[model samples]
Target: MSAPAKASADPAAPGERQGTRRRRHKGIAGNALWFWIFVGPFVVGLLIFSYLPIIWSLVLSFFEAYNTATPSKFVGLRNYVDMLTDHNFLSSLGTFTIFAVFIVPLTFVLALALALLVNQVKIARAFFRSVFFLPTACSYVVASLIWKLSIFNGVRFGLANTVLGWFGIENIAWLSTVDPPWYWIPLVTVRLWLQLGFYMILFIAGLQRISPTLYEAAYVDGAKPGWQVFRYITLPQLRATSVAVLILNLIAAYQAFDEFYNLVGNVNYARPPLVYLYSISLGSIQDLGHGSAGALILAVIIMIVTLLQNRIFGFGKAGD
Candidate 1:
């Protein structure tokens, strides 16, 4: 009778353990259900809106789609062939290349300089920072329009012309001529004004993160305040930030469309890749096939460049 009672008690203990496991499993299942409830909509939306379009466009690139919903035929790589050989397309690429080369370094230098200056300001720093960063909130289209209509317009009353007139220079049509390529002035300045503050903010953050004790130690070892301290301590410490800024600058340069389009408006000169591809979508050249091919090519190029930069720079890692 004692053995039977003891065995019956042992059976209850096993049942209790099994019951606890079932409760734990139920709790886990309930938590998982809530997690899916939160994240499922966003994931589904992304797939529908973003990923599906990308995949569809890729398939569209392979077909002879000409201003139609359904593709006419599978033309293989002919669209890509035509896109690569296009004169307007080639020239647009050249324009992008030149713009990237000039703007990347210029923005980097100017942003770094502004960062250094702003980082040193002890009083009214927030005021100066806000003033500089306010331009970033302005639309590129608005800025481009302002530059075109008020600042760099060919009229003598234009700000740039008025300033130049003081030096006895005649009013020049900034966006009307390809001979002098003066359109680049407005294009470059508007972009710089819009973007510089953002990069400056980044550099400022990078600067703030540097330990003050390093500078103190350098001072104790007879390192002077200006270039010596900057070159050895500041510059070296900012390598990661520099790489990030340069990568961003390069991508921004290549993706430039709003300023160029708003400023020039289908002009023969200085048309970027986006402008050329867009032109293909409108007005006498509505070949959707080739345009899709060009877009994919540009996308691939951007992806490749980004990957290369990441591989070379080793972002978020310890630098040599």
Candidate 2:
């Protein structure tokens, strides 16, 4: 046994394994370096532009930062107290609540109707989709302006008044009269026009995701063509999509500023939370502290509402 020279058991094996490991380590390091190189700037920018501003705003909210962004004259929770107690702000919220109640359902139903109708069309489907979706590309500001100046300018020449004139009705001041709150008509319509198309697209996507086999099975079970199938199958299938649309609609209703601001202008009755906060921040008050406090409060309210909606709808659950 001692005479048998021990064969060097793959003498290069250990060195080759070590070299492979070195190469792997170098490759890993290179990938890591490249990742950081690409991602570092975005991270830095987010901290600087988004997070820092929020932190600064929070800090300013604690102080008397009137007409300025910098924190000055620490007043603790005075800004929050004043904002919460402000009658005008509370009234605006009340009005907004009524508006939300009206708009959310209207938009949901209209969009769903449009989606169902569009989904039924076997020919020129893309053309219809594009036609419906074109409004979503429109600027809210531009839409507001058109609705304000051309459609419902509270003048005899305005489109709405002109339509009424043809109907043997008097040319009514739509925006100018707060007594009837007729401004809501244009506000609601413009928002519907701008939003309905986008939501229709969402519904269309949801509709497409429904398996045709389900419909076939329903038909086999003697389900009717329209109402019965829709009530029993289509609607239930679109539950998640409905929840999402409702949530988005509610939030958008709350954030309605451009239309209110452009159309209603300084009308105490029509100012939503954003418009009210805008006035507080940029108006004669110029109270940055109060504006920041209001914004934070609105954000908290929106978050709570969104959570409640998710809980009620079981948004992310498998069954939902």
Best by TM-score: 2
Listed in order, each prediction's TM-score against the native is 0.87, 0.89
> Where in model 1 is the C-alpha error above 4 Å?
1-41, 282-284, 316-320
CA lDDT of each prediction against the hidden true structure: 0.89, 0.89
lDDT of 2 by residue, 1-320 (tens): 64322333444666666767899999999999999999989999999999998888788789988888876599999989998999988988888998898899999999999999999999999999999999999998999999989988777899988999899998888887777878889889999999999999999999988899999999999999999999999999999899889999999999999888888886788889999998988799898999888888888899999999999987887254
lDDT of 1 by residue, 65-126 (tens): 87764686999999999889988898898999989887998999999999999889999999
Candidate 1 Cα deviation (angstroms), residue 7: 30
**Could you tell me which residue pairs clash in candidate 1?**
none
* TM-score for candidate 1, residues paired by index: 0.87
